[model samples]
Target: MKFTLNTRKVLEFNRILNPLQNCLRMLVSKHELISLFTLFFLVYNLNMRSIISGDTLPTSLLPFCILEHRCVNLDSFGAYIETINNPYMFRQIDGHYLSQYPIVTPLIITPLYLVTYILLKISSCPIDMFNPSFQSIVLLMEKLSASSIASLSCIFVYLSIKNLTNKKIGIISALIYGFGTDTWTISSQALWQHGTVELLLAAMIYITIKNELLENKLNYVFLGFLSGLYILNRPSDSILALPVILYIFLKMNKENIKWFFALVIISGSFLLIYNIYYFGNFLGGYSSLSDGMELNMEVLSRLVGLLFSPSRGLFIYTPVFLFSVFGYLTIKDLPNEKLRFLLYALGLACILEIMVYSIFFWWWGGHCYGPRYLTGILPVLAIYLGLYMNKVSKEPNRYFKFLIFGLIGVFIIWSLFVQFVGAFYYPMGNWDSKPNVDENPQRLWDWNDTQIMRSFHAGPYAYDSRWILLFHHGFGNIYNKITKISNY
Candidate 1:
């Protein structure tokens, strides 16, 4: 005899919209879904997919010295860091800047560098193991570097929120910031200064925190040093602190003038030196330099979209963060709260928006969908919005909050999976041979005028009827398979 289902089971069954279940809600039948995963699974089944896939190349080599791996004695930014750790004989003798990469990144990645350096030293391994241009070593270094920055950013986000709210709220904020999809993805890659947004936010928050810096005096002096580095990386970072500067002026009245002057002197010194040293000018590193830039209008347009209305005013970067807009404004329980946060966050957004408009080349989505340069701003934006989402969900049923942010977390995890899988897939020669389909793998590459080949999007190959092409390398028909999956 059939038994009646309980109310609990009924409710559980009704709420069967889990992410795993969602994945199963396919556009095709069960057999077809099996076919699809089977196809994907086969592509990734190869034991050493990453080796065949050239995706890990960037991770293996540093991008300093105008983007070459081992052009010696160029005084490049990366060479600077390597010199510090490895003691390059010629660069030290030459006293050059080409030997160094940006100190900002080296400073951030120091822990990893130091550890890697020590391990190599202790093991008596060659220093090439720590060289950023050494692909295998560099890739490992880059991944560790990315993880460190991500963890650091997560810690800072937690502290920033915790400074403003309760520990519970801080934990919530930290989790969101740490696990948000974009932050996780960007942080997982060996992107440069990708943690700058966190640093920028920290500076903004510190400056905005009433008289914290000015009253403390010494902290303001140090912040000045940071401010210089901050401005050097992205001038727009300075704008993030303006609201706090204005707050000090308004609150401290006449006394704030000294504070402002001191702040300016400190920030100016670094920028002054950066310009003098990098480009042999005190005020014209990027502000006045114009040369062979591949300025693309489309890339610039997308860069402007980070906070513009077309991006739904920042929600596109973090869809789960749509709720954060209100929390960001409302969390400031005092007039100062609203004044400082709205002005600082919004102020930073405004300046970044302007810079995006002004700069044409060196932008993302020009060649890749995930713009590498803008990643510096992405973490903070994601953290700010993610924290806001967590905050709002508190008033609603905690379960609902959990459900919403939980889904957000799930989405973030999915994105993370994509990044993680993508991160390692190419180096592994990923492939699957389960479907029993036989086809030449030559379609994966496109011949160019320069004689050097590159991968083309799958559809173009299919349209051109070159899916099989001539000689294939690793996998058979991966391009067609991926293109077909993407079409759906």
Candidate 2:
């Protein structure tokens, strides 16, 4: 009887152990493991250099909307009057009190803030708006939201590429977006407006490439909703999306057109009402050409800087975009007109975004990493780059193969290093200046300061850089300090 019992126990242990071992093997062989690993990597980077206080600007628009739900931020009246800053970024109306930015971000962020507020209240914790604990909670939620959104964008890029091309190209495209670009730094690291824009834009491109609308009319409705959200988020960049929208409408059947139009109208109506209530104008408080708005004749210089400048260039920070140029060269070989038109619309959108940003005096996009204004179009670039990769696969020249792949590998490494620098070092700009007055007046192209490189030097600043965060002190110290401060 004892021997039979022991034999049964041994068999049961093997049964469990075998499955566990097989599971490990399966993870090693499949892309799911890579996906999880990449998500964790993004989460880790986002949580690394978080700020607990004093960084809120545009995001404040959200929490205020939630807590107050008023059209105007009445409290900002004194500051607006005192500042008399640029109307393009922020405006205080003469009769009504309101800020200039759109309400979509606030709409999304408010629910999260409310949930956090309620949880703290339920726990009987003292809630001081400026307290370290409350601020930490808010920042944590923001980081988590941004990182999760960014990760979803990565997944979308991966799926879009995988479905359109092959698994290999898909994985590479996802990894490139996840790490080899400012999406990791600007989009994932904090609640920058770019994070939300990147997420929504990536979703738009993903749905476009997924070609689900051909199968289901409902997809067009969904696309319409996304279109509305895009317009709400950043009206300037919305023009970039017009080509894509037009293509969708042209392709849609007559029956679904009403649904698409209805959704867009609903979104537009909300925007119109919000503007009227706040600014008493349908367009809200926008700066006219007389108030320093015009085509920056410096477009030629701006164009060069946007593509090549070390500090602000899109191609410098995200060199994988170079592949897109190659992809553009091979655009003629695309399998279908639908795919070809998709590329054209996306390309024009990217060019328009870059051009608009370049024409603005604040083209560098204020104290962030790597052409943040252009971040929304990155998914569009990555998808096209995947097509470029597919073309390369068919090319038979070994030397050509080695040259392209070698350049890509080197560029990827360079891009990752720059982002790593961004992740660790403090952004060095005069963030305190009033919105209208160019705070960091130094030209992006002329500015010689490179914080990423400076972090490597031996000095007091180096001691505070990410090198210390990784090597000497460790990330645990950040958590410990937060806990210690919370206790106080």
Candidate 3:
């Protein structure tokens, strides 16, 4: 077994690579690992950490209240709320200050806040919500937690598409959902309810698809739980519950159907009880939102604005989703009747969601970037895109397929660019505030001064660098202290 030095080195290199090669082989063969890799990839994009919507401020702090004070109300943070003075996001119910938005998202992310709280305590860093130095850390935590949840949606997207079509299409569809939509810019950048809703919807789709192929009682139970949580997360999205219930009713056996409804009732009871106790209504704080909605002649314009307006247009922000229309039109081509029905139901749900939001006074979704109101429907649209991608994968004509694929590639790139601008450069120019899009809804139609163009003009590096510096400054002090203690 005598060998020269070069041969010994060669053997050492191969030995090191053997484990890595096996790991790579396993990751490629297993869809689960590939999906997890997608999660890490989506979460690590530091450029997205620059923006946090004020709507998420209460959610960012609610987790702390839950962990430290054993309460959902933000009573302890009254001084901080006063300092920020963002009244739209909070509600004064009796004597307690609660989040005006859904509470389930904050409740779900509470464990993440707990982990960060423990780490800060271990590092001897002060945990003050009011401290300018610490506020960025809180925002960072919200960004990371939201990003993680949004990334998980991408995982389910991959799994669902893979089950329906193939691995290649699954990967492409997952990337499109994660990077080419508001999932990256809006949902992942803050503790918006949309991220949680998207995750639930994606999981439900996966469970439904998986159960269709291989029957599972637990899947039905999980689907019902998701449906209930979906209702509590965003009341506007509750329209989707109808389609979900119908799908289960049509497909599941009697025993499984009972299990499904039982879980739904159990999970939904929390919201109903909380609403009754706090707001004296079943809808909780969202009752006020319902009051602001009305059907009028303006509904037609709003419906058009939701799809084509410059500021909050769905197509303007994510044009790649236009293919979903094609997917919907060709739904009859799908072999599975159940899958076809689900797609049609989801399509109708999406339309209803748009119609419902169009009547709301705040259809532009406040100060945030892009079509945030449309975010809840993104998973459905993404599924439609996946369907179209699956069809494209099977296209027999080489030139026609190439042309179609090239067009898709261009749209995807443009969509990703738009989302990148939103993630890093939003609110830089104060386009949402100067005229106040809420006060003057007409600004939404101003093609001359668009949100995307304004964000680009403001530039991403300037805004993103400020966040990078804040993170460095906040974490650097903790790192220095830990190093000093270790040396001691």
Candidate 4:
């Protein structure tokens, strides 16, 4: 009787599908189906598989950073709070503790923490909130916050490129933005400011593109709000949005300008209030951090290392971005001068971001993977890639088509391999292993032992990939042997 009922349901489902098969085929192309699968592939791996393997702030400091952890109450002593070193929290002048990082990211994900806490309590779980396992729960929350926003960023990339070019180009743009770039390795890994900033930046680009096609006052208002959130997430990386802001300014009339300014002022006012309350300054926590950093020859050297060094270079991690050079060269072929100007302005903004990172003391982006500072500008580069794809598709030569696409395929494979290995396979602190060079006192910069190569060696050597160790001296020994370094 059960078999008969199952057979009837299967037959009914097939009968329904048989009538709609042709309609479904017509509505969804094979290419679109493949593209959607690719989108899901990138999003799932980048988010779910990229959780912390070691020494990540999201795991170690996020609970305290968000004020979720506190000293145990007498009534619930040893049951509710776990006493730990609290490495990332700083005591305020008034004796209250806050994270050294800005509050925007923790604030954004607070509700997730609340929900997780509620679920834990409802289940009558006998877990301490400060146990190492508790961080795993918050990490799940981090994955949801980062991945969901990142998925939205990818969709906006598709929509922006589709409006500017075609669906194929849009799909490729989103893939490149989500997977074939540092956006995958860094932004999708945790609830970092860079990931949130990337989402906001992507939204800004999409809105900017939409406003260009059809002027909308509300768009500018939203852009203003996003700009504020962008700064709050990461103050320095906010430069990534300047091009869009300038483009908006260039197109606005008196009435539109008034609307934009009104929203901008409101957003700015919130930032000021948040800052004054926390850090006793209108500029916020970043104001305390801005002093005593300057540019020099050493800074220039670190900049080169960040861009071209074998281990840390942005291009090495995501080779698909090399197409961005062509993106600049082919601007004349763009549909209009306004779009071309937008590209130029955005390019300058990217350069400005690099310069900002260069001047900073720790140019290597401490304890993370691959040029993490540039995550915000990656969507801009993806647009450039869309332009490159658009240009090559228009060419008439068959050999040129084969050669260009073949090259792109190779680079895309390399990027996917790097990101996948970086997410799940590579040791978190594998690169920071050498003795201090005279040039770098912190031993963070390594030019020859690229992270890709380190990952290859990590598994074979049974390296300490554990997330809990304060330092892995074995990696340092391995680095010395590989780099053949003596006393400097």
Candidate 5:
């Protein structure tokens, strides 16, 4: 009778815990949840956000302006603008100052700003842009929002690769994309358009691969929308859209194709109206900047600089991507015919991106770290890396496999270290503006005065002490007070 009673009790206990156990399993198994946890881990590990560009200054403010002032123009921020005097980032349109960069990024991140605005209102925290506390809040929100978008890109990167190969390859490639590329140092740091562009591009690739695996009309529609946004985000890189359009046209059914075109037209119409309203032109505020872009023999030097220069070179900053060259050379050996063709199309896009940027007057991308212009093509490079990894995993010769993996490990560590400097120690030495890189373009190629070397000499924590103290103290106090209350 005693044994029977104990067995019944154990059975009852298990029955009571079954729901909790299943919930835990579901959470662990979900890819998105894992990605979110990874994002938080990266954010917590850094514990600092670097606002490194004047280009993103207007974007940081536009979201708050849209929510509070109910206007796109930066008239309310006139005092702040006057203080900063960043002429290149803003333009006077219709007698009102507005962001010169694409407005879509600001609009995308407006919700986060809205949430911050609401919380401040609830807590009676003064919402002044000039106030240190308010400024800290804005900076925190920018980091979180940008990091979140970058994380989303990594998620898609993993999914795309997983679909192409296997789970191990997917996870490894995603980590490389998330940490070893500019996605970590640049896109996750501030409200740069690159983060949004990356997310859109990664999603496009994921959807393309998913569609190839299982045909779906909805995939075409999503691809079309992303394509429209991608072009709008960076019009100069519109050449990157060729592969996507080709894929849609060739693979999608007539009805799906019609839907795709309709979505693209709709997104285009939105841009058209916004541009016409603000700048009185379809090209929007970028028209003046585009005038300087020309194809010339001088582009050859830029092509070399963009590839190999110490300051702005893609390969210099992120050497892990060099494996992508091997991946491209072995493209013909890929078993999936559709994926192989897609990779070829992407290769063409990457080539065109390099050629187009090389012709631009500001090919070094001005006052930024490490090949910012080449950031858009990183997703393609990451996929290629994944391809190489997949091939390496299947190599029959253990010795050769060990040698290749060892080489990749070295590159990965170096890439991560370079990005670490960019995220934490950039601009500490004032390398960009000491002589102004634009005025002294030769500084970019100088091995003795490389941005990486200068940044390292400056040491970590190179940003303003006042801002750092305010962020830590202000948030730290609030956190402690909350803990006290919860304990009570």
Candidate 6:
């Protein structure tokens, strides 16, 4: 065992790979010695942040982004996974919750989860995945999951680009994804948003290829399965898949064909398992848990909020992506075939998306479930904007291309700012990230961490301020002492 580990270390440190090569290193086969080394590096790199999350990082919502001493969504879903596995503690409804959670995200996580569990049990290892008590297994699983999310997103983007355009487009798209702001943010998190969204987008793209472009009707089975999984993630974007499904039915509008039944059965089987077990219903585990169904007179207000809302809307945080969509659309013509196809598809998707988003806006109040709601369609949108870019200046001068790339470069820099700089300096988020900032919704001013800290209820940082509370807890007394002195 000692020799084996020593050899693994040698392979891991053999060379420092560039970001692209480093990200793609995991494709190495399970049986290969080199792959094993890469895996070790991946794990070590993730655990390098142990100071933040007790080695595994909080799977919790607030802490993962903000980085506090807490485990993230484990309680919501991970705990559900645990409860189901523990037979004696199992409640039927609890089991059903696991079965049903828009569970597409959880399902993507299952393989790594199972592997960690198996290793823990097999080797009698006491590695806990959540706390230090279970830190060993949890940390290990998180590291693997993080890498998997990164690697899979790369593959997914490549496939989506390749399917929509060509090999070059695919490589460029994947590179953008690897380096892009949102993808980078999502991937780095110790939570489900990145992995889950990636799966949902991939599934949508797969359906488009299978039903419309590819000649394979048999492939709809995977399409339907992924569609069901898509619903599990954001549920709102599930409507977006209608185009692909409609494509499947267009050829056989009159008949309930054999392939139709196969699609239903294949997708339904997996989903039914989730639904019946999760929500005690055959079809509604995730939707049942969503915040959108209830109707109100002010549903009109919610609708307005959906498009322009501070938190969930497209225009809120990243306005450039929105402008890029606009810039792409206004262009007169696109020169290339692949660019034209991508533009047309994206235009159609965007219009379809707008219609659906409008319909649901009043219902859900703009999906503040993080920025994840709109991210599903980003890959398609990026290509759309890229084409318009080609059209806007049929020829981008070196300076213009540099300017465009540099503006994108600014976004890249800002992306790093949001994650690393924003985390420490901005903490909860900056002024731009706050919701309903103009009218100030909740019952106070700066109702964010600042207001909460200053108020009598005070919450976590009542004594100083959220800024002080944030770094202090992570730093323990050292931060508090410095702040305490600064107080003088």
Cα lDDT, all candidates: 0.43, 0.66, 0.83, 0.66, 0.82, 0.45
TM-scores of the models, in the order given: 0.55, 0.78, 0.90, 0.78, 0.88, 0.58
* Clashes (candidate 5): 0
Score candidate 3 by lDDT.
0.83
lDDT of 3 at 271: 77
Q: Quote the lDDT for 236 in model 2.
A: 67
Compared with the true structure, what per-residue lDDT tens digits does model 3 show for residues 371-463?
988988888888788888788878999898899899999999999888878777776788988888788888999999998998789876453
lDDT string, candidate 5, 1-488, tens digits: 99999999999999989989998768767755475547634752373655557788788888878888888888887766777754678887667988998887887789877766765655556656788787777677777778878888888888888887788898888888888888877788888888898888889989988888788888878888888878887787778888888888777488999989888877777777888888888768877766778788889999999989999999999999999999887779867787788889999999999998898878998888789889888888998899899999999999999999999999999998888787778867888888899999999899999998898799885454545775577656656655676899
Per-residue lDDT of 1-488 in model 4, one digit per residue for the tens?
Answer: 99999999999999999879966666566556444644654555532444552333433344443443542111222223235354343334354444456666665556556655554544443344455444455455566566656776777777778877898898878887777776666666666777778778878888878887887888989988777777666778877777776776688577777777677777667666767776788656577556636777888887776677666678888888898888777777877666678888888889888888888777776656677777878888888888888989988998998899899989989988887667665654355544333245334444455667776567532322332231233233344544553443
Compared with the true structure, what per-residue lDDT tens digits does model 1 show for residues 427-482?
A: 12212222111242121111221000111111111111111231141122334544
- What's the lDDT of the predicted structure labeled candidate 6? 0.45
Cα shift from native, residue 408, model 1 (Å): 5.4
Q: Which candidate do you rate higher for TM-score, 1 or 2?
A: 2
Who is ahead in TM-score, 1 or 4?
Answer: 4
After superposition, candidate 3 runs with Cα above 4 Å error: 1-44, 124-126, 461-488
- Which structure among the candidates has the greatest lDDT? 3
Better of 4 and 6 by TM-score: 4
**Candidate 1: C-alpha lDDT:** 0.43
The window of 10 residues in a row where model 5 has the poorest summed lDDT is 36-45
Residue-wise C-alpha lDDT for candidate 6, range 404-427, written one tens digit per residue: 766765664543333332122222
